[model samples]
Target: MNTLFTVSVRRISHVCTLKPYKETKWLMPYGNPTGIYVYNCVANQRVPVILSDPHIATWYSCGPTVYDSAHIGHASCYVKLDIIQRILKSFFNVNLVTAMGITDIDDKIIKRGLETNTHFTNIAKQYESEFWLDMNSLNIEKPLIITRVSEQIDCIASFVKKLIDSELAYVSKTGSVYFDTSKFPSYGKLSRMQDEGEPSDEEKKNKMDFAVWKGHKPGEPYWDVPWGSGRPGWHIECSAMVSKVFGSQLDFHAGGIDLRFPHHENEEAQSCAYHNSRQWANYWIHVGHLQVKGDTKMSKSLKNTISIPELLKTYSADTFRMACLTSNYRYSMEYTDAAMENAEEVLNKFKFFLKDAIVYINNNTATHPCQYKDSILKELQKVQDGNIEALKTDFDTATCINNMLNLISSTNKIIKNDSSGYYPVTVTLIVEYITGVLTKFGLKLQDGSQENIFSDMLIDTLVEFRHTVRLNALSKKDKELLNACDIVRDKMKSIKVQINDSNKTPSWVLIK
Candidate 1:
């Protein structure tokens, strides 16, 4: 087996290994190269990504700053990334080790603390807690590692010192450190921006160069380092955390489109300069910005930002997730009431179809040597292959969803026109396929309600008792027993349970 070396900054320890890529059946031909191809921002073209190790893929996403409550714009980015990760796991059968860094000590955090008259550390903790709560409600998977800037201060300072020693960075008169962009010829390659024409602030020597460490301020939080008593810059925090957790290179780096310039560009330059590698991350994925209904961008300054909690009060998490998936990840999406309402309607239709399918399977018996069994099985296989192919091409979830809808339509038509009801195998296959896809998208048919084993046993007892009473009523022609059966039916109906009496063995289904 091949082995890859790992790098540590200062105090943190991380293990890294390089493994050979394993071929899989899902590989397809597209984007001028084979396998899964995604648009690389730096390459300015669609490039194929062949993982070094098929079993494990590394991913890093720029997490929230934790200074303020996360809004819908933030939700759009995280939800999209979550969906992409889900597809990579389920569709591609790859194990993902994802990391997201939290900016706990930042300029914004200090500003917010002064405004609220609270300690910056307290403010950061409070908002971080709130951010995790929102992520839980949205059903997002927690990252394998969450690195905080405050925790990685020592590592960050060590990284800056290495850059300065290599002549890639310089210390200013204020005892702060800044990266010398001129030293790194490919500094603007990721962002594709030219060098800055003029310096806006007189603090640094060049306009394009950015601060890796800031000087100590009177009231702001500071950490003791070789350079001075100041905190790490925003870009340096991410670079340090990535180096400590993922080592010199990552399989994928993702963030919103806004980070393409300045933030990500700077991160790429710094990491490459420190590691002496030409590339920092193999593939760069960015989700498009989210806009309000009036074509206005969602920003705190505009006072039009919608908080995640506020939106959750009006819409289900699944609904919001569906709305985000309907659009292409690379294209900007407009968040409107109508879009969410439409998504809710689509979700309801799926639930209704699944409910009916489940009821049909339970109520009817499987026919031996069924007529439509072969054809139905073949059709399901065809749909499954189509869905996988669509996903292989840049994760076109919209197309995958459309294919699901088409399958549902076809299933409905087949059931309506057939003289005989669906066979047991047919119903089982259709239900399993639909449910599997829904699970991949992080969706569920039921409205947060589940029947426990005890509840199931009780329902079975009631059904058996009702069946016995009905049989006795038939034998003796007793009116009281008939009334008791009707009462059971009424109660079941009130609880949204539908019972089928047409078959010899009664089976019930719960409708949402």
Candidate 2:
């Protein structure tokens, strides 16, 4: 069984400790696209963002095929959905639950099973475990409930029965139940496929023509259903799961842009056929693809993919989060060593600032009130307010995170140049606010290292243990050691105190 964790509003501090990812009131709400059409890989046409009712928002994301490990592109989709979920809870004050289902039943599983001469269930288990490990390493919160296609046969059959009774679905001679696209007039509305053009003749001939229930096939998983013994099609599996879990109406449905076509489009068509209603999702959000080097989709089929487990072994989870946040969820981004390096560098800088701030807080002697207390509070409010407003305008995460980085940069500068200690109130207010926000994003301010003591320890340990004696020392012994240790520590620990103490003498705050 998978472990689950929930955050109640009352546990504000406990929630604060999460890695730099949180839902704030100022984040985006569930609604229609307000301005500028985002590229919809589903409709193949850019549609205006339109949000329906906010109170009843729910989400569903198609999960990984447990036949393989997760890749960077998969991480991109999860990050986008995570961002959307954050906005929904923060802005609408609505209970937003996301169900990400695993495709544990598929040809891929069968093929792997046959190749390895292993039981299909064991194959699925092995790959699913690998996927879970990868997602956890990326700091992604598990979905509310993960439904598997094989475990949902009865639900799929019931939904298929509805389509059949409504005359929207028909079982062909092959014993496969398929949704007749011709019966649904708005067949391609979600992807705007009809507006662009109709499916060619060959596209319609296959009985899997948007297979709702696949009849028994050799060497594949099957379950007894009203229609026959078969497996559910990829798209039908989601509709049935959603219906079983949350019913027909959903607040939002999200997946990678690549799934907009036959996958998501067919899902909408079949789901609507079950209800015979117009409303499905209040808002449909699709995340752009993550490109490999040279602008190619990072997919396993192409043999050009970066597995999450391999990535975590090298870079920290926070590094991955930072990389994803650096790009807007709507835009396609290339994953390269350069981008990862930049994100790591920036994160390191923030860590350094946080360490300095912590030390400064601990070392402060004066009890004077902060001068710009109100001003700092006002700035924080602006950030909180502005970030929410920007997010509402189509989940502009780039703007949101940019605002956060700007605030971090400004706060750091203020801590470095504390000429007049009058603004202690302002300093405290800003520090508290930043810490709160960083907590939401799951980044914590690390502490517990003795500033002077650790400094002394480093000097003794480094000078005594290493053989480079009588090194060219330009400054005093203390200053020289501080500089050397600063390089060794890379300014990560020293910056914590800088944000908290403004009155300290202007000297090496433990390297840049």
Q: Which stretches of candidate 1 lie over 4 Å from their true place?
A: 1-34, 365-369, 373-375, 417-421, 451-512
Task: State the lDDT at 304 in candidate 2.
Answer: 89
Model 2 stretches with alpha carbons more than 4 Å out = 1-56, 90-92, 195-208, 365-370, 373-378, 444-512
* TM match of model 2 to true structure: 0.74
lDDT per residue (tens digit) for residues 121-164 in model 1: 99999999999999988888889999999888889999999999
Span of 10 residues, lowest total lDDT, candidate 1: 18-27
Candidate 1 global lDDT: 0.76
| Candidate lDDT values, in order | 0.76, 0.63
TM-score of every model?
0.80, 0.74
Residue-level lDDT tens digits of model 2 in 1-54:
111112221221111211111111111223433343334443343434433443
Predicted model with the maximum TM-score:
1
